[model samples]
Target chain A: MPANTLTDMILGFSVIIGILFLYILSLTLRFKQEKRKASLKNRRNIA
Target chain B: MINKPKLLTVFDILTALTLLGALALILFWTPVEITMGPVQKVFYFHVSAAWAGMLAFVAAGAAGAGYLITRKLHWDWVSLSAVEVGLVFGLIAILSGMIWAQPIWNTWWVWEPRLTTTAIMELIYLAYFILRSSLETPEKRARLSAVFAIISVITVPLTFFSIRLFRTIHPVVIAPGGGDSAFSMTPCMLRAFLISLGVFTILLVDLFWHRYRLAKLNYKNQTGEN
Candidate 1:
Protein backbone atom coordinates (compact mmCIF):
# COMPACT_ATOMS: atom_id res chain seq x y z
CA MET A 1 0.00 0.00 0.00
CA PRO A 2 1.09 3.55 -0.63
CA ALA A 3 2.18 5.29 2.51
CA ASN A 4 -0.49 7.41 4.18
CA THR A 5 0.81 10.76 3.01
CA LEU A 6 -2.61 12.33 2.97
CA THR A 7 -1.79 14.46 5.98
CA ASP A 8 1.31 15.87 4.37
CA MET A 9 -0.69 16.64 1.25
CA ILE A 10 -3.26 18.50 3.33
CA LEU A 11 -0.61 20.53 5.09
CA GLY A 12 1.07 21.46 1.81
CA PHE A 13 -2.14 22.62 0.15
CA SER A 14 -3.28 24.47 3.25
CA VAL A 15 -0.07 26.50 3.35
CA ILE A 16 -0.35 27.24 -0.35
CA ILE A 17 -4.00 28.26 -0.29
CA GLY A 18 -3.80 29.91 3.10
CA ILE A 19 -0.90 32.12 2.04
CA LEU A 20 -2.76 33.16 -1.12
CA PHE A 21 -5.91 33.99 0.84
CA LEU A 22 -3.91 36.06 3.28
CA TYR A 23 -2.32 38.02 0.44
CA ILE A 24 -5.69 38.68 -1.13
CA LEU A 25 -7.00 39.82 2.23
CA SER A 26 -4.03 42.15 2.67
CA LEU A 27 -4.57 43.67 -0.77
CA THR A 28 -8.26 44.27 -0.13
CA LEU A 29 -7.63 45.88 3.25
CA ARG A 30 -4.86 48.12 1.99
CA PHE A 31 -6.92 49.23 -0.97
CA LYS A 32 -9.81 50.11 1.32
CA GLN A 33 -7.64 52.15 3.64
CA GLU A 34 -6.03 54.02 0.79
CA LYS A 35 -9.37 54.71 -0.83
CA ARG A 36 -10.82 56.05 2.41
CA LYS A 37 -7.84 58.31 2.95
CA ALA A 38 -8.09 59.67 -0.58
CA SER A 39 -11.80 60.33 -0.18
CA LEU A 40 -11.29 62.09 3.09
CA LYS A 41 -8.61 64.26 1.58
CA ASN A 42 -10.98 65.20 -1.22
CA ARG A 43 -13.68 66.12 1.31
CA ARG A 44 -11.32 68.38 3.21
CA ASN A 45 -10.25 70.07 -0.02
CA ILE A 46 -13.90 70.79 -0.97
CA ALA A 47 -14.58 72.43 2.43
CA MET B 1 -9.77 56.99 -8.72
CA ILE B 2 -10.98 54.31 -6.40
CA ASN B 3 -13.46 52.94 -8.91
CA LYS B 4 -12.19 49.58 -10.13
CA PRO B 5 -12.36 48.58 -13.74
CA LYS B 6 -15.02 46.05 -14.80
CA LEU B 7 -12.37 44.04 -16.59
CA LEU B 8 -10.49 43.53 -13.34
CA THR B 9 -13.72 42.38 -11.72
CA VAL B 10 -14.16 39.85 -14.51
CA PHE B 11 -10.57 38.76 -14.03
CA ASP B 12 -11.15 38.34 -10.33
CA ILE B 13 -14.11 36.04 -10.91
CA LEU B 14 -12.33 34.08 -13.61
CA THR B 15 -9.24 33.62 -11.46
CA ALA B 16 -11.30 32.38 -8.51
CA LEU B 17 -13.32 29.91 -10.56
CA THR B 18 -10.36 28.52 -12.50
CA LEU B 19 -8.34 28.18 -9.30
CA LEU B 20 -11.17 26.24 -7.65
CA GLY B 21 -11.46 24.01 -10.72
CA ALA B 22 -7.73 23.40 -10.74
CA LEU B 23 -7.73 22.43 -7.06
CA ALA B 24 -10.63 20.05 -7.58
CA LEU B 25 -8.94 18.45 -10.57
CA ILE B 26 -5.73 17.99 -8.63
CA LEU B 27 -7.38 16.49 -5.56
CA PHE B 28 -10.17 14.44 -7.13
CA TRP B 29 -9.21 13.62 -10.70
CA THR B 30 -5.50 12.97 -10.51
CA PRO B 31 -4.54 9.53 -9.36
CA VAL B 32 -2.26 9.16 -6.37
CA GLU B 33 1.13 7.69 -7.11
CA ILE B 34 1.66 4.09 -6.01
CA THR B 35 5.02 5.00 -4.58
CA MET B 36 4.44 8.44 -3.07
CA GLY B 37 0.69 8.40 -2.45
CA PRO B 38 -1.20 11.63 -1.66
CA VAL B 39 1.82 13.78 -0.86
CA GLN B 40 2.89 13.38 -4.44
CA LYS B 41 -0.08 15.58 -5.25
CA VAL B 42 1.95 18.42 -3.78
CA PHE B 43 4.42 18.18 -6.65
CA TYR B 44 1.99 19.55 -9.22
CA PHE B 45 1.24 22.80 -7.43
CA HIS B 46 4.70 23.11 -5.92
CA VAL B 47 6.37 23.07 -9.31
CA SER B 48 3.69 25.34 -10.71
CA ALA B 49 4.22 27.89 -7.95
CA ALA B 50 7.94 27.84 -8.55
CA TRP B 51 7.35 28.39 -12.25
CA ALA B 52 5.04 31.31 -11.53
CA GLY B 53 7.56 32.85 -9.17
CA MET B 54 10.28 32.68 -11.77
CA LEU B 55 7.99 34.13 -14.38
CA ALA B 56 7.27 37.06 -12.05
CA PHE B 57 10.96 37.83 -11.73
CA VAL B 58 11.28 37.75 -15.49
CA ALA B 59 8.38 40.14 -15.81
CA ALA B 60 9.96 42.44 -13.28
CA GLY B 61 13.20 42.52 -15.22
CA ALA B 62 11.40 43.27 -18.46
CA ALA B 63 9.42 46.01 -16.78
CA GLY B 64 12.62 47.36 -15.33
CA ALA B 65 14.02 47.56 -18.82
CA GLY B 66 10.89 49.31 -19.96
CA TYR B 67 11.29 51.97 -17.26
CA LEU B 68 14.94 52.51 -18.05
CA ILE B 69 14.14 53.05 -21.69
CA THR B 70 11.03 55.16 -21.42
CA ARG B 71 11.83 56.75 -18.04
CA LYS B 72 8.18 56.16 -17.22
CA LEU B 73 6.99 55.64 -13.67
CA HIS B 74 4.29 53.25 -14.81
CA TRP B 75 6.87 50.70 -15.83
CA ASP B 76 8.44 51.08 -12.43
CA TRP B 77 5.02 50.44 -10.95
CA VAL B 78 4.79 47.28 -13.02
CA SER B 79 8.23 46.21 -11.86
CA LEU B 80 7.40 46.89 -8.26
CA SER B 81 4.09 45.06 -8.49
CA ALA B 82 5.72 42.04 -10.10
CA VAL B 83 8.32 41.89 -7.35
CA GLU B 84 5.68 42.08 -4.61
CA VAL B 85 3.57 39.37 -6.19
CA GLY B 86 6.65 37.32 -6.96
CA LEU B 87 7.71 37.35 -3.33
CA VAL B 88 4.37 35.93 -2.23
CA PHE B 89 4.53 33.08 -4.77
CA GLY B 90 8.14 32.43 -3.85
CA LEU B 91 7.16 32.13 -0.22
CA ILE B 92 4.44 29.67 -1.19
CA ALA B 93 6.85 27.58 -3.22
CA ILE B 94 9.42 27.42 -0.43
CA LEU B 95 6.86 26.64 2.26
CA SER B 96 5.10 23.98 0.23
CA GLY B 97 8.40 22.47 -0.84
CA MET B 98 9.43 22.23 2.79
CA ILE B 99 6.13 20.63 3.72
CA TRP B 100 6.43 18.06 0.93
CA ALA B 101 10.07 17.42 1.75
CA GLN B 102 9.22 16.46 5.30
CA PRO B 103 7.43 13.35 4.06
CA ILE B 104 9.59 12.47 1.06
CA TRP B 105 13.11 13.56 1.89
CA ASN B 106 12.50 12.93 5.62
CA THR B 107 13.80 16.40 6.46
CA TRP B 108 12.45 19.93 6.85
CA TRP B 109 15.36 21.50 5.03
CA VAL B 110 18.41 20.65 2.97
CA TRP B 111 21.43 22.62 1.91
CA GLU B 112 21.28 21.26 -1.62
CA PRO B 113 22.02 23.44 -4.64
CA ARG B 114 18.38 23.93 -5.68
CA LEU B 115 17.21 24.86 -2.20
CA THR B 116 20.16 27.09 -1.51
CA THR B 117 19.90 28.87 -4.83
CA THR B 118 16.17 29.37 -4.38
CA ALA B 119 16.68 30.89 -0.94
CA ILE B 120 19.31 33.19 -2.31
CA MET B 121 17.09 34.17 -5.24
CA GLU B 122 14.18 34.97 -2.91
CA LEU B 123 16.37 37.07 -0.65
CA ILE B 124 17.83 38.94 -3.57
CA TYR B 125 14.42 39.97 -4.87
CA LEU B 126 13.17 40.71 -1.36
CA ALA B 127 15.87 43.34 -1.04
CA TYR B 128 14.04 45.26 -3.76
CA PHE B 129 11.43 46.31 -1.20
CA ILE B 130 13.98 47.39 1.36
CA LEU B 131 15.83 49.34 -1.30
CA ARG B 132 12.65 51.08 -2.40
CA SER B 133 11.58 52.02 1.12
CA SER B 134 14.91 53.67 1.79
CA LEU B 135 14.78 56.07 -1.15
CA GLU B 136 13.09 59.40 -0.35
CA THR B 137 12.23 60.57 -3.88
CA PRO B 138 9.95 58.59 -6.14
CA GLU B 139 12.23 59.09 -9.12
CA LYS B 140 15.27 57.90 -7.20
CA ARG B 141 13.37 54.95 -5.84
CA ALA B 142 12.14 53.92 -9.28
CA ARG B 143 15.52 54.25 -10.95
CA LEU B 144 17.48 52.39 -8.31
CA SER B 145 14.88 49.67 -7.88
CA ALA B 146 14.63 49.25 -11.63
CA VAL B 147 18.37 48.73 -11.83
CA PHE B 148 18.28 46.33 -8.92
CA ALA B 149 15.40 44.38 -10.47
CA ILE B 150 17.31 44.05 -13.71
CA ILE B 151 20.47 42.86 -11.99
CA SER B 152 18.81 40.47 -9.51
CA VAL B 153 16.94 38.49 -12.20
CA ILE B 154 20.13 36.50 -12.72
CA THR B 155 19.19 34.47 -9.68
CA VAL B 156 16.08 33.03 -11.38
CA PRO B 157 18.05 31.07 -13.97
CA LEU B 158 20.66 30.18 -11.38
CA THR B 159 18.01 28.61 -9.18
CA PHE B 160 16.26 26.87 -12.09
CA PHE B 161 19.41 25.40 -13.59
CA SER B 162 20.78 24.35 -10.22
CA ILE B 163 18.77 21.11 -10.31
CA ARG B 164 19.88 20.09 -13.80
CA LEU B 165 23.44 21.24 -13.39
CA PHE B 166 24.02 19.87 -9.89
CA ARG B 167 23.45 16.38 -8.51
CA THR B 168 20.70 17.44 -6.17
CA ILE B 169 17.83 15.43 -4.72
CA HIS B 170 15.41 17.96 -6.22
CA PRO B 171 13.57 16.12 -8.98
CA VAL B 172 14.11 17.01 -12.60
CA VAL B 173 10.50 17.30 -13.70
CA ILE B 174 10.96 18.72 -17.16
CA ALA B 175 13.21 16.92 -19.65
CA PRO B 176 13.68 14.24 -17.02
CA GLY B 177 16.71 11.94 -16.71
CA GLY B 178 18.86 13.30 -13.99
CA GLY B 179 19.38 9.69 -12.95
CA ASP B 180 17.59 8.98 -9.66
CA SER B 181 16.51 12.57 -9.34
CA ALA B 182 14.20 12.47 -12.34
CA PHE B 183 10.44 12.07 -11.99
CA SER B 184 8.69 10.55 -14.97
CA MET B 185 5.05 11.50 -14.80
CA THR B 186 2.23 9.45 -16.23
CA PRO B 187 -0.10 11.01 -18.81
CA CYS B 188 -2.74 11.91 -16.20
CA MET B 189 -0.13 13.38 -13.92
CA LEU B 190 1.33 15.31 -16.83
CA ARG B 191 -2.10 16.71 -17.73
CA ALA B 192 -2.74 17.85 -14.18
CA PHE B 193 0.74 19.30 -14.00
CA LEU B 194 0.29 21.30 -17.20
CA ILE B 195 -3.12 22.54 -16.06
CA SER B 196 -1.72 23.54 -12.70
CA LEU B 197 0.95 25.54 -14.47
CA GLY B 198 -1.63 27.35 -16.58
CA VAL B 199 -3.79 28.09 -13.55
CA PHE B 200 -0.86 29.44 -11.61
CA THR B 201 0.13 31.67 -14.51
CA ILE B 202 -3.34 33.14 -14.58
CA LEU B 203 -3.19 33.64 -10.85
CA LEU B 204 0.12 35.43 -11.19
CA VAL B 205 -1.22 37.78 -13.84
CA ASP B 206 -4.30 38.55 -11.76
CA LEU B 207 -2.30 39.28 -8.66
CA PHE B 208 0.25 41.34 -10.59
CA TRP B 209 -2.47 43.45 -12.15
CA HIS B 210 -4.02 44.08 -8.74
CA ARG B 211 -0.68 45.09 -7.34
CA TYR B 212 -0.03 47.39 -10.26
CA ARG B 213 -3.33 49.13 -9.59
CA LEU B 214 -2.46 49.49 -5.95
CA ALA B 215 0.88 50.99 -6.85
CA LYS B 216 -0.78 53.46 -9.14
CA LEU B 217 -3.24 54.43 -6.41
CA ASN B 218 -0.49 54.85 -3.91
CA TYR B 219 1.41 57.12 -6.26
CA LYS B 220 -1.65 59.23 -6.94
CA ASN B 221 -2.48 59.55 -3.25
CA GLN B 222 1.02 60.60 -2.27
CA THR B 223 1.36 63.07 -5.10
CA GLY B 224 -2.19 64.38 -4.75
CA GLU B 225 -2.60 63.99 -8.46
CA ASN B 226 -5.01 62.05 -10.63
Candidate 2:
Protein backbone atom coordinates (compact mmCIF):
# COMPACT_ATOMS: atom_id res chain seq x y z
CA MET A 1 0.00 0.00 0.00
CA PRO A 2 2.71 2.45 -0.90
CA ALA A 3 1.55 6.01 -1.51
CA ASN A 4 3.16 5.90 -4.93
CA THR A 5 0.55 3.38 -6.11
CA LEU A 6 -1.86 6.31 -6.02
CA THR A 7 -0.27 7.61 -9.22
CA ASP A 8 -0.97 4.32 -10.99
CA MET A 9 -4.59 4.42 -9.86
CA ILE A 10 -5.00 7.96 -11.08
CA LEU A 11 -3.42 7.14 -14.41
CA GLY A 12 -5.60 4.06 -14.89
CA PHE A 13 -8.84 5.84 -14.10
CA SER A 14 -7.86 8.85 -16.22
CA VAL A 15 -7.21 6.70 -19.26
CA ILE A 16 -10.53 4.91 -18.90
CA ILE A 17 -12.49 8.11 -18.42
CA GLY A 18 -10.65 9.93 -21.18
CA ILE A 19 -11.35 7.19 -23.70
CA LEU A 20 -15.03 7.14 -22.84
CA PHE A 21 -15.20 10.93 -23.22
CA LEU A 22 -13.62 10.81 -26.66
CA TYR A 23 -15.96 8.04 -27.75
CA ILE A 24 -19.08 9.85 -26.60
CA LEU A 25 -17.85 13.03 -28.25
CA SER A 26 -17.35 11.20 -31.52
CA LEU A 27 -20.82 9.73 -31.33
CA THR A 28 -22.35 13.12 -30.65
CA LEU A 29 -20.55 14.85 -33.47
CA ARG A 30 -21.43 12.11 -35.92
CA PHE A 31 -25.04 12.18 -34.89
CA LYS A 32 -25.24 15.90 -35.41
CA GLN A 33 -23.59 15.67 -38.82
CA GLU A 34 -25.95 12.99 -39.97
CA LYS A 35 -28.98 14.87 -38.78
CA ARG A 36 -27.86 17.98 -40.64
CA LYS A 37 -27.20 16.06 -43.81
CA ALA A 38 -30.59 14.40 -43.66
CA SER A 39 -32.31 17.71 -43.16
CA LEU A 40 -30.55 19.38 -46.09
CA LYS A 41 -31.44 16.49 -48.36
CA ASN A 42 -35.05 16.79 -47.30
CA ARG A 43 -35.00 20.53 -48.03
CA ARG A 44 -33.66 19.95 -51.53
CA ASN A 45 -36.26 17.28 -52.21
CA ILE A 46 -39.04 19.66 -51.14
CA ALA A 47 -37.63 22.52 -53.26
CA MET B 1 -35.23 13.34 -39.37
CA ILE B 2 -34.59 10.55 -36.96
CA ASN B 3 -36.15 10.97 -33.56
CA LYS B 4 -34.42 9.95 -30.36
CA PRO B 5 -36.67 7.60 -28.47
CA LYS B 6 -37.96 8.70 -25.08
CA LEU B 7 -36.84 5.46 -23.49
CA LEU B 8 -33.30 6.13 -24.64
CA THR B 9 -33.38 9.55 -23.04
CA VAL B 10 -34.42 7.95 -19.78
CA PHE B 11 -31.76 5.30 -20.18
CA ASP B 12 -29.07 7.92 -20.78
CA ILE B 13 -29.77 9.64 -17.47
CA LEU B 14 -29.98 6.38 -15.60
CA THR B 15 -26.74 5.07 -17.04
CA ALA B 16 -24.88 8.28 -16.14
CA LEU B 17 -26.18 8.16 -12.59
CA THR B 18 -25.29 4.50 -12.20
CA LEU B 19 -21.82 5.11 -13.57
CA LEU B 20 -21.23 7.92 -11.08
CA GLY B 21 -22.43 5.72 -8.26
CA ALA B 22 -20.08 2.94 -9.33
CA LEU B 23 -17.14 5.34 -9.42
CA ALA B 24 -18.01 6.65 -5.96
CA LEU B 25 -18.08 3.15 -4.59
CA ILE B 26 -14.82 2.20 -6.25
CA LEU B 27 -12.93 5.27 -5.09
CA PHE B 28 -14.41 6.04 -1.68
CA TRP B 29 -16.17 3.00 -0.30
CA THR B 30 -13.80 0.17 -1.21
CA PRO B 31 -10.92 -0.48 1.11
CA VAL B 32 -7.34 -0.31 -0.14
CA GLU B 33 -5.55 -3.59 -0.70
CA ILE B 34 -2.62 -4.25 1.66
CA THR B 35 -0.20 -5.28 -1.03
CA MET B 36 -1.35 -3.74 -4.28
CA GLY B 37 -2.73 -0.59 -2.69
CA PRO B 38 -4.69 1.98 -4.71
CA VAL B 39 -3.75 0.53 -8.06
CA GLN B 40 -5.75 -2.54 -7.09
CA LYS B 41 -8.88 -0.42 -7.18
CA VAL B 42 -8.51 -0.24 -10.92
CA PHE B 43 -9.31 -3.95 -10.93
CA TYR B 44 -13.01 -3.23 -10.42
CA PHE B 45 -13.46 -1.22 -13.62
CA HIS B 46 -10.84 -3.12 -15.60
CA VAL B 47 -12.54 -6.50 -15.23
CA SER B 48 -15.97 -4.94 -15.65
CA ALA B 49 -14.98 -3.33 -18.95
CA ALA B 50 -13.59 -6.63 -20.16
CA TRP B 51 -16.83 -8.35 -19.24
CA ALA B 52 -18.86 -5.72 -21.06
CA GLY B 53 -16.62 -6.01 -24.11
CA MET B 54 -17.05 -9.79 -24.15
CA LEU B 55 -20.81 -9.39 -23.81
CA ALA B 56 -20.80 -6.98 -26.74
CA PHE B 57 -18.94 -9.49 -28.90
CA VAL B 58 -21.48 -12.15 -27.97
CA ALA B 59 -24.25 -9.79 -28.94
CA ALA B 60 -22.54 -9.04 -32.21
CA GLY B 61 -22.17 -12.73 -33.00
CA ALA B 62 -25.80 -13.40 -32.18
CA ALA B 63 -26.96 -10.49 -34.29
CA GLY B 64 -24.78 -11.69 -37.15
CA ALA B 65 -26.46 -15.08 -36.93
CA GLY B 66 -29.82 -13.37 -36.87
CA TYR B 67 -28.98 -11.45 -40.05
CA LEU B 68 -27.90 -14.65 -41.80
CA ILE B 69 -31.19 -16.30 -40.92
CA THR B 70 -33.52 -13.35 -41.57
CA ARG B 71 -31.58 -11.15 -44.05
CA LYS B 72 -32.80 -8.11 -42.11
CA LEU B 73 -31.01 -4.78 -42.18
CA HIS B 74 -31.63 -4.17 -38.49
CA TRP B 75 -29.68 -7.27 -37.57
CA ASP B 76 -26.74 -6.04 -39.60
CA TRP B 77 -26.89 -2.67 -37.86
CA VAL B 78 -26.89 -4.39 -34.47
CA SER B 79 -23.95 -6.57 -35.47
CA LEU B 80 -21.91 -3.62 -36.69
CA SER B 81 -22.71 -1.45 -33.69
CA ALA B 82 -21.85 -4.19 -31.24
CA VAL B 83 -18.52 -4.93 -32.87
CA GLU B 84 -17.50 -1.28 -33.05
CA VAL B 85 -18.47 -0.61 -29.45
CA GLY B 86 -16.84 -3.82 -28.33
CA LEU B 87 -13.56 -2.76 -29.86
CA VAL B 88 -13.56 0.50 -27.89
CA PHE B 89 -14.28 -1.30 -24.63
CA GLY B 90 -11.66 -3.94 -25.35
CA LEU B 91 -9.05 -1.27 -25.95
CA ILE B 92 -9.93 0.39 -22.65
CA ALA B 93 -9.62 -2.93 -20.85
CA ILE B 94 -6.24 -3.68 -22.38
CA LEU B 95 -4.76 -0.26 -21.68
CA SER B 96 -6.09 -0.17 -18.13
CA GLY B 97 -4.90 -3.70 -17.49
CA MET B 98 -1.44 -2.72 -18.65
CA ILE B 99 -1.42 0.28 -16.32
CA TRP B 100 -2.41 -1.90 -13.39
CA ALA B 101 0.15 -4.53 -14.35
CA GLN B 102 3.03 -2.04 -14.43
CA PRO B 103 2.82 -1.51 -10.68
CA ILE B 104 2.04 -5.11 -9.70
CA TRP B 105 3.67 -7.35 -12.31
CA ASN B 106 6.88 -5.27 -12.49
CA THR B 107 6.33 -5.00 -16.23
CA TRP B 108 4.15 -2.96 -18.56
CA TRP B 109 3.48 -5.75 -21.04
CA VAL B 110 3.55 -9.55 -21.18
CA TRP B 111 2.89 -12.15 -23.82
CA GLU B 112 0.81 -14.25 -21.49
CA PRO B 113 -2.00 -16.43 -22.78
CA ARG B 114 -4.84 -14.22 -21.57
CA LEU B 115 -3.16 -11.07 -22.80
CA THR B 116 -2.22 -12.52 -26.15
CA THR B 117 -5.62 -14.05 -26.77
CA THR B 118 -7.38 -10.82 -25.90
CA ALA B 119 -5.11 -8.92 -28.26
CA ILE B 120 -5.90 -11.41 -31.01
CA MET B 121 -9.61 -10.97 -30.37
CA GLU B 122 -9.22 -7.22 -30.80
CA LEU B 123 -7.36 -7.71 -34.07
CA ILE B 124 -10.03 -10.04 -35.40
CA TYR B 125 -12.70 -7.43 -34.89
CA LEU B 126 -10.49 -4.85 -36.54
CA ALA B 127 -10.26 -7.20 -39.51
CA TYR B 128 -14.05 -7.36 -39.57
CA PHE B 129 -14.16 -3.58 -40.19
CA ILE B 130 -11.52 -3.84 -42.87
CA LEU B 131 -13.56 -6.54 -44.55
CA ARG B 132 -16.63 -4.33 -44.45
CA SER B 133 -14.84 -1.34 -45.91
CA SER B 134 -13.42 -3.29 -48.84
CA LEU B 135 -16.77 -4.54 -50.06
CA GLU B 136 -18.59 -2.54 -52.78
CA THR B 137 -22.24 -3.39 -52.41
CA PRO B 138 -24.29 -2.96 -49.26
CA GLU B 139 -25.65 -6.48 -49.41
CA LYS B 140 -22.22 -7.99 -49.85
CA ARG B 141 -20.79 -5.86 -47.07
CA ALA B 142 -23.58 -6.80 -44.69
CA ARG B 143 -23.47 -10.47 -45.53
CA LEU B 144 -19.71 -10.77 -45.43
CA SER B 145 -19.35 -8.75 -42.25
CA ALA B 146 -22.07 -10.84 -40.60
CA VAL B 147 -20.26 -14.04 -41.44
CA PHE B 148 -16.96 -12.62 -40.28
CA ALA B 149 -18.46 -11.40 -37.04
CA ILE B 150 -19.90 -14.85 -36.28
CA ILE B 151 -16.65 -16.67 -37.01
CA SER B 152 -14.35 -14.22 -35.22
CA VAL B 153 -16.37 -14.34 -31.99
CA ILE B 154 -14.95 -17.81 -31.39
CA THR B 155 -11.94 -15.95 -30.04
CA VAL B 156 -13.99 -14.38 -27.27
CA PRO B 157 -14.51 -17.56 -25.29
CA LEU B 158 -11.00 -18.70 -26.00
CA THR B 159 -9.70 -15.42 -24.62
CA PHE B 160 -11.93 -15.69 -21.56
CA PHE B 161 -10.80 -19.20 -20.68
CA SER B 162 -7.15 -18.81 -21.57
CA ILE B 163 -6.01 -18.05 -18.02
CA ARG B 164 -7.90 -21.04 -16.67
CA LEU B 165 -6.50 -23.31 -19.32
CA PHE B 166 -2.91 -22.05 -19.18
CA ARG B 167 -0.36 -21.49 -16.47
CA THR B 168 -0.43 -17.73 -16.58
CA ILE B 169 0.49 -15.09 -14.03
CA HIS B 170 -2.74 -13.24 -14.79
CA PRO B 171 -5.12 -13.33 -11.86
CA VAL B 172 -8.41 -15.19 -12.06
CA VAL B 173 -10.76 -13.26 -9.81
CA ILE B 174 -13.95 -15.18 -10.38
CA ALA B 175 -13.29 -18.88 -10.71
CA PRO B 176 -15.28 -22.06 -10.21
CA GLY B 177 -12.81 -23.60 -7.76
CA GLY B 178 -10.37 -21.64 -5.65
CA GLY B 179 -8.27 -20.16 -8.37
CA ASP B 180 -4.77 -18.69 -8.48
CA SER B 181 -6.15 -15.28 -7.67
CA ALA B 182 -3.58 -12.68 -6.84
CA PHE B 183 -5.65 -11.17 -4.08
CA SER B 184 -8.74 -12.12 -2.12
CA MET B 185 -11.70 -9.72 -2.09
CA THR B 186 -13.28 -8.39 1.03
CA PRO B 187 -17.08 -7.94 1.10
CA CYS B 188 -16.83 -4.20 0.31
CA MET B 189 -14.46 -4.87 -2.54
CA LEU B 190 -16.81 -7.51 -3.87
CA ARG B 191 -19.74 -5.10 -3.72
CA ALA B 192 -17.82 -2.40 -5.52
CA PHE B 193 -16.73 -4.87 -8.19
CA LEU B 194 -20.27 -6.04 -8.81
CA ILE B 195 -21.59 -2.51 -8.94
CA SER B 196 -18.95 -1.55 -11.48
CA LEU B 197 -19.90 -4.55 -13.61
CA GLY B 198 -23.58 -3.61 -13.46
CA VAL B 199 -22.86 0.02 -14.36
CA PHE B 200 -20.68 -0.96 -17.28
CA THR B 201 -23.38 -3.31 -18.54
CA ILE B 202 -25.84 -0.43 -18.57
CA LEU B 203 -23.31 1.81 -20.23
CA LEU B 204 -22.76 -0.85 -22.91
CA VAL B 205 -26.45 -1.00 -23.73
CA ASP B 206 -26.69 2.77 -23.90
CA LEU B 207 -23.69 3.06 -26.19
CA PHE B 208 -24.93 0.21 -28.34
CA TRP B 209 -28.25 1.96 -28.86
CA HIS B 210 -26.51 5.17 -29.90
CA ARG B 211 -24.16 3.31 -32.21
CA TYR B 212 -27.08 1.43 -33.73
CA ARG B 213 -28.78 4.72 -34.45
CA LEU B 214 -25.67 6.00 -36.15
CA ALA B 215 -25.53 2.86 -38.27
CA LYS B 216 -29.15 3.28 -39.25
CA LEU B 217 -28.46 6.87 -40.25
CA ASN B 218 -25.51 5.78 -42.33
CA TYR B 219 -27.59 3.09 -43.98
CA LYS B 220 -30.28 5.60 -44.83
CA ASN B 221 -27.71 8.02 -46.24
CA GLN B 222 -26.17 5.30 -48.35
CA THR B 223 -29.50 4.23 -49.74
CA GLY B 224 -30.60 7.84 -50.43
CA GLU B 225 -33.55 7.35 -48.16
CA ASN B 226 -34.83 9.53 -45.34
After superposing candidate 2, which stretches have Cα over 4 Å from the reference?
Answer: A1-3
lDDT of each: 0.92, 0.92
| Candidate 2 lDDT score relative to the true structure | 0.92
**Model 2 Cα lDDT, one tens digit per residue, B1-226:** 3899999999999999998888888898998888888998999999999999999999999999999999998999999999999999999999999999998999999999999999999999999999999999988888998999899889999999998888899998887666656457898888888889999999999999999999999889778876
Residues A1-47 of candidate 2 have per-residue lDDT tens digits of 35469999999999999999899999999999998888888898899
Worst 10 residues of 1 chain B by lDDT: B175-184
In Å, residue B13's CA in model 1 sits off its true spot by 0.9
Give the TM-score, chain B only, in order for the candidates.
0.97, 0.97
Candidate 2's error at B203, in angstroms? 0.2
